[model samples]
Target: MSERVIAPKSRGFLFLDSHPTGCRRLVDEMWQAVPEPVPAGGEGPVALIIGSSAGYGLAATIAGLARVGIRGIGVCFEKAPARRTGTAGWYRTAATARLARQHGRDMVFLNGDAFSDTMKEQVAGLLAERFGGRLDFLIYSVAAPRRTDPDTGHVHASVLKPIGSPCTTKTLVFDDDGAPEVKEVTTPPAEGDDVEQTVAVMGGTDWERWITYLDDRSLLAEGFATVALSYIGSPLTAGIYRQGTIGAAKSHLEATARALDERLGKALGGRALTSVNAAAVTQSSTAIPGIARYVGLLRGVLGDAMVSPTGQLVELWDQLTGDGPLVLDEEGRIRLDTWELDPAVQDAVAERWSVATSDTVPELADLDWFGDEVRRLYGFSVPGVDYSAAVDTEVAWPTRIN
Candidate 1:
């Protein structure tokens, strides 16, 4: 008898994999939506955006420079080392670099950790030395689990919550029946190091490091501005984010922005701001423990209007270029996710939440479509791909990672 071996458990890594052609299609679609010529290079003024590998970081970088006529160099830390489905950042760098070259701009890729002093010094030096010590904008966004601190040699910890209430909630996963349903609360380590570690890497310290180093070297150009990314979701993710360790870190990041804004505004006649951004499922958002539930729920309500794997990217570009139709406060933090949490929407979700406990619970009205977008985000559901197409396991990347 022939033995049948089952596939290995996908673990969380499945979330990391991305389909390049789909992502490229998304990128191309976004690029086309920009009404003006995207220079593809921030040649004259210097701009820096970290965590520039995937999702918002990548989107913001592209959008900021597209119409602004500045050629920029992108630095990212990626594991898979190439422009393949395994490492989305690699694909982004590879594809973006190609566009840069074609557009008569310069794009360089530096692969490494943003937290270490070595990386910090390297980045700062690159700014000062590479482009004549001038920067017009800086974006500090680092999301990682751990980093070896170069300073006190201690791994600084990040806390995710106020030390008070511990909220818990329901989540969903496919059961043996091959159908999706709620799973009980996935309690994180009650003790709490992961949150702290995540906050340290993702929060404000690295952001500060980038700003201070660049400023000390007198690299900031006049009228320079900087922004850090943040999120405050509806109460659904309260247990996993706001009430969780990462939430604590986000709180720290928000407060730190206030602090940095004052100092940077004074010194460089520039500003350090916060963008409490829109929610879309990206690699970082998915790993936050119970986030898949929110992704599904949010998707069900808004459906395609909620998030488009490709068009939303154009939405980001529109926002960056001042052509966006959404409302924004003085801080420019557009509350895109807030509209989804209006009272009526929340009530509807609550009703669904109650039914979520049952085996026969129905799929949220727009869930399949929502899932379709999410799957497309990972390159699973794009048009024109034959599932049986042989994937080149030995595909070479545009730029090789170190």
Candidate 2:
């Protein structure tokens, strides 16, 4: 394959092509941010990270390898480079595998649909053969538009709409000049089985199934634990996010975590819980209606206090593997969004939300920083990356299972 300089091809927040070298640089920075590993008695923890290509999943994988010294297996679905550039997650995963090798850690990337029985079976066999047949931890961080039921073969698609009534909220849209412009977006309520389908796709059914499948094959370790990433925005975004169809799905996920906690407790002295993470610029979050505006305002208010997804997951590893007891909320979840939900932070964001306009929002929120972060997600505006230099896009995952 010949090398060529690849610029970002995006419409709104949807990016089509990714730069491999820039993605590798971002992965390297994330690895560098990881603190020194805590002492693991043996070969560290063996973990299975589903949806481990981008966002919190990718962060968790890096933290586990560099901070917790884990031997990990990652499962994600991504398109490889062909006529066009490959997806950002593809390059990120390959870079992470390379990082694992550099540190002499065992890491495997499986390129396939993680919500399928075949992939689950393949991971189980890999665990038995290559990972010593014991899984210490399972991290679930999948965010997809649709999911096909492994048992019934029904396709469920998730929708980002309100549940009861239409929601009209103030949001931000990038204009022709690449500056954020204030706009009002109205999303209609869920119709027919929209809520149910959203729940089916984004719910904890697949998470539960993965655990059951692995447990049936005796793959869980003595002190096994599992965590699924979730979010509960403040009342500002409640109408469209927390009170919407996705909220219904998140409710199911939390309930599943409780039930799994009970089951794991009785079976192998294990645990299951959800980690409510903070908002950040992610490919999935960009699709939500008011998330962009909220995140911008959040960054403006929180400023240096805002924690990136990688930082949050690094702290999570400390809490999970530390000597002290786990600090949980009233609902048995690890609250990683405390900073974002602080009263002072929310008050400031609300004040800006009330009076923000296309002309005034530039002064109220750090839209320029937000734009740079979004571009970095696609490996376009990362620091120290030469966009003019021709680079090969055909990067391969060194330990891909499929």
Candidate 3:
């Protein structure tokens, strides 16, 4: 691997994010993707958006509100208040909420957990009081694996351990060498509390729970539409996600889509939609062991990866907002992950892996210009900043529901 200068982690270029203009560029791309106008600018119904702080939740809130004109309410589950600097989602939500409020949009922020009964009760009450129990959308966009199981009251931790025996494959970082390095990853088997526990935490249980409660309380609107995100990445994620406990849990989630479609579709006038969303580099995915380095090395191997230049993980975020060409709907459910798993793409990536090794330096061929984009997401690797810039450090949440 060639040594690129280590970039400091802090605000570098954009006012809020290093690449402010670059961020807008990505947003514009999303704006272009919704061929059918995703209407916005309204004050009619309510939109309960879980995980609206960052990731898909944030994109959904923006897209659904900006283009679709779902000018309803936004319910965010953020525990950033408990943390000093607050969560990344905190600032993103604040910036968007501020912009929305200035434009006469109805928006609300909450610093609470979405998996708790108390949180549910409070949000439900808010919706009832504000929108008269008329919520048109319920977006279950959360992606956390750590939650307290309501049934057992046990704090469950999701596992990424593979189901069967460990598997090994060649890893790619360089292609100059004629041969590749034989790298094997051993995924431990999840037994006892691992499998069941992981399922309880990441499966459709919480999603089902939320719908049942909302319906029982007569909170859902007549044409209510609900969507939950799911993904099955290519073999690149096999060592970490596939053949692991998390994979098992994901399977559980994938299965729930059908059942939820059946139940929610009937209840919501056949508008329950499940999208196996696109796969790209994500914050959560980046942090997983081996994935970060793999992605980094991939940037060198895949020449097409582009940098945001404005401190945003542009490509990944675009996919999350359903603003890309890869999304294809079968009936109503969208196959967003299909592109990531395309045989040709996977074959090309794997073939590169077979020919790359530590002894040889990899060339940028398939990677896009997404390096700066990925780095900007964490407020790093951006250009045109003092690096010693300062701030008041006294920003407050636009709305605190706790």
Per-prediction CA RMSD (Å): 5.0, 1.7, 7.2
**Over the stretch 306-353, how does candidate 1's per-residue lDDT look in tens digits?**
643233334544554356764556654544455566788777766776
* Reference-based lDDT, each prediction: 0.62, 0.90, 0.56
User: Model 3: residues >4 Å from true position, as ranges?
Assistant: 1-40, 73-84, 167-185, 293-333, 359-371, 382-386, 400-402
- Quality of model 3 by C-alpha lDDT: 0.56
Assess the local accuracy of residue 43 in candidate 2 as a C-alpha lDDT between 0 and 100.
81
**What lDDT tens digits, residue by residue, belong to model 2 across residues 266-290?**
9999999999999989999988888
For model 2, where is the 10-residue window of minimal lDDT? 34-43
Most accurate candidate by lDDT: 2
For residues 1-402, could you state the per-residue lDDT of candidate 3 as single tens digits?
A: 111222233321111233222233344444344445433445644677777766666677666655444545555654343313334455566666665555555767666778998878887887777666777777777777689866678897876666666534433321233232324445556667787778887777887788888889998877676767665666766765756777777677666777877876676764555656554455566445445335544555444432221112223224334455424465445564454456765676566555554454235222233345455454444444333544322346776332
Better of 1 and 3 by TM-score: 1
In candidate 2, stretches whose alpha carbon ends up further than 4 angstroms from where it belongs are 38-42, 400-402
Best by TM-score: 2
What is the TM-score of each predicted model, taking all chains together? 0.82, 0.97, 0.76
Off by over 4 Å in 1: 1-9, 12-18, 33-44, 67-69, 81-86, 156-166, 175-178, 186-198, 307-336, 357-362, 393-402
* Superior candidate under lDDT, 1 versus 2: 2
Per-residue error (Å), model 1, residue 125: 3.1
